[model samples]
Target: MSWRTARRICRPTARRRRKAQWRKAVDAVAGGIERASAC
Candidate 1:
């Protein structure tokens, strides 16, 4: 496949993976805040 075709196929998956990581990070921060407040 050409570079452009490969990049088109790969880009969304990378973006999705990054979004998932960001969500997980946000969830972890929220959980930490809750725990701190509960203490």
Candidate 2:
């Protein structure tokens, strides 16, 4: 595949992975806060 085609495919996958990682981080923080508040 051409460089342009490769970039187009890889860019979205990278973005999706980054988004998933961010969501996981947010969820972990939220969980921690909830646990702390419950105490």
Please tell me which predicted candidate would have the highest TM-score against the true structure. 1
Tens-digit lDDT string for candidate 2 (1-39):
599999998999899999999999999999999999999
lDDT of 1 by residue, 8-34 (tens): 999999999999999999999999999
| lDDT values for all models | 0.99, 0.97
Task: Name the TM-score of candidate 1.
Answer: 0.83
Distance from true position, residue 17, model 1, in Å?
0.8
**Each prediction's number of clashing residue pairs:** 0, 0
- Candidate 2, position 15, lDDT: 99
